[model samples]
Target chain A: MNAFPPVPEMVAAVRSKRVAPDHFVTESLRRLEQHGGTLGAVLSLTKERAQADLAPLSARLAGGEDLPLAGVPIAIKDNICVRGTTTTCGSRILESYRPPYDATAVERLVRAGAVIVAKTNLDEFAMGSSTENSAFFPAKNPWDLARVPGGSSGGSASVVAAALVPAALGSETGGSVRQPAAFTGIAGLKPTYGRVSRYGLVAFGSSLDQIGTFARTAADAALIHAVIAGRDPRDATSSDHPVEPNQARSMDLKGLRVGIPKEGHDSAIDARIRARLSATQERLLAAGAVIRELSLPHAKYAIPTYYIVATAEASSNLARHDGMHCGVAAPPEKDLLHQYLRNRAQGFGAEVTRRILLGTFCLSSGYYDAYYERAMRVRSLLARDYRAAFEQVDVLLGPTTPTPAFKHGEKTSDPLQMYLADVLTAGANLAGVPALSIRAGHLTEGGSELPIGLQLTGPAWSENLLFRVGAAIESYWPEADRLPPFVRSQA
Target chain B: MIDENLVRSVAHLARIAIPEARVPGLAKELAHIVEYVDQLAALDVQGVAPLTHTNAGANVYREDEVAPSLPVEAVMALAPARSGNFYRVPKVIGDA
Candidate 1:
């Protein structure tokens, strides 16, 4: 267990009679039940359903079925619909929201034989960068209990990092996936815009929300992604692009070109992370990659543009949860307007409310041109910069986030400081490129170790290239296998 | 570029009653944010024709068809108070 077992290894073991899927899934349910309330990593557990699945699924495994993820226990982010489970999105309003259907990602994982063990926590409606904004229990980082797990997909990172499951699903709305991955020191990927279906993911910013995965290794991520990536008739925004398998096996970086943007070396990035990014590039160079320098002139505007556009979409998408519906209804409001207003104010947490307000203002009649339209224009220029650089290089390398996990409440009071957590990650979402966060190193401050991540990005649907470079880099740093003490103690 | 009056007005539209007490603090935070975003206007795109997306796809939306709505009883069951098939609510906007 000390070695980070790839999903394929676990599958092979289950298939070869080394371990039983029932035994593994049973223990996983027990461990999740024991750790759920304590770690706050899980919001709901599919106990009876999981138990019922084991017998038939175990029979399938024993019969030598070609399951994409045989006996691999995976968690779904609460925002991602898991048919019978509560997709809370970490808000009190949807405390009992049980969608009659599964999200496209869930269906893909299930059909591929991945068990939906539990649903992990998330920021309310995927609004904040830190998990603290969750109206339910906040997911504590496995690396440091007192510190926050970078969110809104923080719980997904924590579980995979904690080894509660071999893999999990996470969504990124402006680095929600990658930042938490960097903060928790796991490998997480945000597929290119529309690469995966958005059919049942509770919408945040439809343009930027991407359903991705968190796994211990890049190869495992590629395998899981292959299962989930395809056109969905349900999601109009989903790409019908032909599915391309990971070419990582064929990826020999002997002459592959790599680019490093000079803007990535800004003041906000931590020194340790910067050094790790440099070291990763050096390793790639040693592997025969021609590393070049690329500068994104408008990199600084990414945060503003992301916040403006994401929040604007969030405000509209969230309007459907009027209390009179299945969500928390206000106690007998006077009329329809009162019903919507009262329920919304009470249902949403402080952070969710703040974003809705900000988004509403940006999309308001008087300010749309100045804010929303302007942000869209800026988004184009950012995409152009990446395109111009991509013409010269195959992939880009950088730190996933400035610093690793910040302490809980470190930036809660200062809104802008909180926004800066995604400084290194926001640009990818704006550019609509695929990016991944892979655990690279560790930092020690006051004897409390924090995990660091190296971000590798590629042009649309170029995630295969990321797996190639990241798996190469993952070989150099073996700490990815080292379990957080909390996970071991709880086990 | 942002003002307190606009903040109140936006708050009104959003339906959240932000106290005047918090308006000053909220305005200050929003100002810093606006200054950061205002830089977008500085780009030298005299006629770059704002691009919608680097990759565009038309909506494959299916025709809206009538299907089984949530059982009216199950749906209204969630409402706080009700009279007949309609939901009952407080007296909103005078006698109307």
Candidate 2:
């Protein structure tokens, strides 16, 4: 059975006192205990912490205080700090480090009466496309235990898909949230850059990173988005642009101008997935939405540009984990420099080390102009592409990933093959646009049916419009209500 | 091509000690990624501006007021090694 009802239903029930807040927490904890280990979705459950805070929250709710996310049980990707909780970014280095403060989003979630029950896993420092790069363990897809739940937000995506949690917070540097959500057949939203605050979110590609939401449906994703997104003085990059709750009032697709980016439909995409995307477009057309073939000519460069810029920032941002102040340290050595090196070397996993090296090389003095600066110039061009395309249509549509989730160890050995997983989704991060990924279709591969997602990206801060379009697609998509095999077998 | 030596040097610069055996493999992987990213060189970026950040906001400043930070003990408690009120590190300017 699902642990809880949808966000709005649960919130209304809890707020109206018909359902006790503690009841959902109990169910969520039970589900986490049941499925978390099997799916490798949970790193640590904050059972004791969550229970201790519930009585007071229960009091607040009983007192008739209005909380938008009242009584909701949510999971946070381990990278985002929850005060006094272990904020491991899926690396052994800071495996046991507890943060002293809550991330701005976490602060908002708690203030709105949401209980953070667990910390989900991710690729180390959100570097790799697959959670297989997690220093501890890879999160498996609920659809097929043999396949990876697309990552670096794999853990968050997995738990939501398996009904371990109603909603989860995942950070996306490049396709982390959307890709994982796509692979897991859930709704994921990467809010426009600056639409959400990054304060206390462990920095990885500071310019590209945004705290995104994952849920079973786009409307639930929007509920979490509304609660968490807004300008935070702590995050200077956060915009003061007005943010209003974007809950879908109607699944109205009338006259919605959706642009089909020609680049997004490249031959590189899996033909099966493309067929699903076309079917979704047909659904939109049937609903009176206008569709146009548009061009984001520079879309192809998004992956390479995102890699350079993201890694460059990661290299600089990760410099703090020298083991001098916190995290795992090397054995005492006479040379401080060597000790620092050894501490980091031992703490970070292979993928983290690779990204750090790549980033360092990109930002190195001689190569800066050729690699990093040039990538930045190309990034500007990519952003311009979105700007121009948005002028032509309200949103750009495409397959979220080239294909469905793959078996573990399939792309692990080949780094390039793994990076390609984000090719279709990373453009939004590069352009700082908001993108929503919702399950549009499913394909039977290797005897198991895996979900495929369609991504709808809009111009910056246009999350409300994206949610509307996503809801329309979700309504038409037959597979949205289907349970993953893992959940089905258990039932 | 990224050579093993370059990989080692880059690791050192990044303050990570990579094993000598892993250097060759890392070098190969970095070379592959670098080569893939080299596609940017073909783009005509002559007139384009570098966008380091998407936020168009200028420097945001606040009043210089004393604010409470995490307690010193709380901050110190997180350190891997600490002596008194300072983080403890290996000898920097002393003989081994």
Candidate 3:
């Protein structure tokens, strides 16, 4: 029997007594164990905790309590804390650290009746664009095993693409969520900064990080987004603005003004992606939406600005893991300085160390004004560009990534090449806007088809509008039956 | 170019050790990244105020009333090494 069902179908089946919660949990675990080794998508499975958490839910369902996500098994990126479970963040530093409290997002999801099935892998500290940076193992794309599922949320994206679970939660600092979702041919949403509470989300870039959802469709993403996106007292930066939570509501695109940034069509974008983008625009135009060309003059600076700002924040944030408090500790030494150095050197992987050093260099006293301050100013300019574009158009459209997933070890040797993969997706994070990556179409490469994502970024707190546009696009180009051949054969 | 000496100094500042053998490779990579980021210098950001926070809210504070905190034992449980009610660490002050 097919164990993987989308969120809505799974919920309906369980609610109507067609399927039991225990059966869903068991089947999900079995499938995860069977396929997880090949994909390397899951870091640790919380089968015992999931079963324990589901027992009371079964009784509650029998009591006729209305639970929107009753019995739905969901995976979370390892970076997000889950109490009493190993939250590795795909780094050796945190190999044994089990958080004492659940992240606000995890707490809310559990309360909404979702079963936490497993913790997925990620780039160490959510720093890399590919899961190759994961301390343990890199997650491979389900469509083509040789290619990568994008990172730092590669594990979450891979599992969802393989239909291991209907949906998973991934965090985005830059393009960690959207890029992976695109590479894996799924839908992912990076909520506006501060839309989701950052409490207990091991910070990579404090200003840019936000928890996002990966699902098979836009509506499914919206369902999970509603449950997780909200303000919390624990997160001081979280927005206190009222949330409408109408993301799942579908709407027509009539009279909508969609802005196409001229910079989005630059030479770096793949021909297939450009063609798919054109097809999407044609579809939008047919749906009674007006497409207009706009400009973001400072767009080229996004990658550089992101690296500086993100790494600088990362350097400061990662300083807490000095072995005395939490995480892996090195053998004791007589001197305190040696202890810190030894523990950190032994704990962090190469990519993480590189970022920490880069960040430290940027924030150092002499270089602060030149690197950190300049990047921040450029970031402001990028935000200004977005605000200006929004005045003319209701939403901005672009490619999620310049190209599709590359082969393993393709860009690992060159750090800048890997960083370029996130170029198109970073602007949304820098602008603090809500962005969604929908599988617009597919591209054939090396005798296999890879997915292409079209990104839609809206003004702050405009997830509802983005989701509507996404749902409409999904309808025009339905991907409901486009499961990878591997998954299809299994079914 | 960022030399090996600069890379070592930065790693020291970050409290991450760079073994002597890897210093040259690390410096080369750091130099490449720094060069890539240096493109920002071409932008005209004169008089543009830096955006430190995405949201407008600042100085968010709750009332000074006491609130329940995580139990000391629970907090200490995650610590790598701890004595009763205290986290144990390497000695900082050395004998003269």
User: What TM value does model 1 have?
Assistant: 0.93
Q: For residues A6-122, write the lDDT of model 2, one tens digit per residue.
A: 888888888888988777888898889988999988999998768866878878976777788888899999999988889899998889889988899999999888999999999
Number of colliding residue pairs in each model: 3, 0, 0
- Ten residues in sequence with the least summed lDDT for candidate 1 chain A: A325-334
Rank by lDDT, descending?
3, 2, 1
Clash list (residue pairs), candidate 1: A323-A329, A333-B90, A334-B90
- Model 2 misplaced regions, further than 4 Å: none
Q: Scored by CA lDDT, what does every candidate get?
A: 0.81, 0.89, 0.89
Number of the candidate with higher TM-score, 1 or 2: 2
Q: DockQ each candidate and list the results.
A: 0.41, 0.83, 0.83
* Model 2, position B2: C-alpha lDDT score: 87
lDDT of 3 by residue, A1-491 (tens): 24277687788888888988766777778888888888989999998889778989878888888788888889999999998899988988899888888999999888878899989989899988889999999989998999999998999999998888889999999999999999988999999999999998999999999999999888889888988888899999998778885558567888999999987788879988998888889988998999999998888889999999999999999998887887644678889999989999988999999999999999998999999999999999999999999999999998999989999999999999999999988999998999999887688999878998889999999998888889888776665348887787773
> What CAPRI grade goes to candidate 2?
high
lDDT for model 3, please: 0.89
Model 1 C-alpha lDDT per residue in residues B1-96, reported as the tens digit of each score: 567887777777887667678787777777777777666777665555554554576747777887564467655655555787786666656763
Query: How does model 1 fare in lDDT?
Result: 0.81
- TM-score against truth, every candidate: 0.93, 0.98, 0.98
The collision pairs in model 2 are none
Model 1 RMSD in Å is: 2.6
Candidate 1 wrong stretches, greater than 4 Å: A1-4, A59-65, A247-250, B19-24, B58-96
